[model samples]
Target: MIVITAPTGNIGRHLLPLLLESAPAHDEEVRVVVRDPARLPGAVRARVEVITGSHGDAGVVDRAFEGADAVFWLVPPDASLNPKDAYCGFTRPAAKALAAHGVGHVVGVSALGRGTPLADRAGLVTASLAMDDLIADTGVAYRALANPSFFENLLEDADSIREKGVFTDAADADRRAPLVAVADIAAVAAGLLLERSWTGRDSVPVLGPQDLSPNDLARIMTEQLGHPVRYERQAPDELYTTLVGYGLNEAFARGVVDMKRAKDEGLDTGVARTADTASRITFEQWCAQTLKPAVLS
Candidate 1:
């Protein structure tokens, strides 16, 4: 049995179809822990066993993990809590449930910066790494997909870009770092869950084909969208204040600021792209295929 958490999310939504189609050939049964079963497509709902509730809930994970062989673990963003509570605290119950249920393999969605000088101070990224540690200690074969920022993040600025020909972030205009497509991350997760051939714990970085700066992204967006586009660098304090104004916990707001600060300072640059680590998606391609449609709409 294979279990998936947050099956209706950006990553999980893409992952479900891949597993449903392929896992059957491997004699695997797919189960999903979700808050709302109706959010699942009708056809998908029929294909998998659904455990209704938050995966962060101990009772939910206890039931979901039972008889499971491998699990795809992705924590949904919960801005109401502090970084530690949102990440590690959410996983603590599930970590125990994994050991108790004897589930052997787990592939979790996490961030980069493990083993770096900045990782310890990178706020949310730090909490994500600690969550990976908590899961690994459960004696499961764990692979934390250490990813950078996502191209999908730009969707948040689609309106801004459409109206003003601009996108915004806290990163310096020239600070280059890897960014990934979430579909690619889902693809990597599905592959690991199906094969389950690897043992022990490690991070599988789904770095996109190359590192791109904010200016690089703006240039690509302009070319792809057939219009002038520009990057707007926002202050970290402004980001924190905005997040807090949205009713996010003060600590969580601080975490968002710290994470952006760390990324701008090269927390994501700790990993070198190799054939094994590099994923096959470029920002330009994403802009044309994904961002263009969103912006044009």
Candidate 2:
């Protein structure tokens, strides 16, 4: 049996069908922990066992993990809360349940920056890595999907790009870094959850096809959307204030700034992509397929 958390989320929504498609062949049972079972599609609700509650709740996770062999774990972002409390706090209960239930494999969505020189200073990344440590300490077989900035993040700026032909960020406009498509992330997670041969704890870096700077991204967006889009680099302080304006707590806002600064300082450049780690989607392909439609809508 495999238990999945955040079944209605971006990755989890895509992951559910993939897992279900493969489950019958493998003779696996699939279950999910959701805050609202109503948010799940009728097909999904009909197929998997649904436990209605946040997975962060100890009781919810404990009940969901019963008779489960593997699990897909992801802490859905809550910017208004403290980063540490949101990430590590959310994982602790699941960790306990994993050990208690003897669930052998756990695939978690985590960020990339583990061995970088400034990892300790990278706020959000640091918290995510710490969460991985907490889960690994349970001695369950763990694979933390160490992803870089997501290509899907670009969609958040789609409206701004459509209206003003500009997007802003704290990172330097010329700094190139890895970016992965969330679909590819889901694909990797689904594959890992389906197979039980691997053991022990490890990090799987799901880097995109190649590195691209914000300027490169803007150029691609311009071509894809048939408009001249520009990249604006905001000062770290300005970015922090803007994030606070969006209702994030001061500490979490600062973490967002720190994460961008770390990326500007080459935090994501430390890892080279291997055939197994490199995802198939390119920035251009994602822009054409995902971002362009979002902008038009």
* Model 2: per-residue Cα lDDT over 24-99, one tens digit each: 9999989999998999999889999999999999999999998999999999867877889879988889889989
> How many clashing pairs per prediction, in order?
0, 0
Clashing pairs in 2: none
Candidate 1 deviant stretches above 4 angstroms: none
Q: Write candidate 1's Cα lDDT for 1-297 as tens digits.
A: 999999999899999999999987999999999999999999999999999999999999999999999999998868999999999999999999999999999999999999999999998999999999999999999999999999999999999999999999999999999999999999999999999889998999999999999999999999999999999899998988888898999998898889999999999998999999999878888888899999999
In order of appearance, the predictions have TM-scores of: 0.98, 0.98
Per-model C-alpha RMSD = 0.9, 1.0
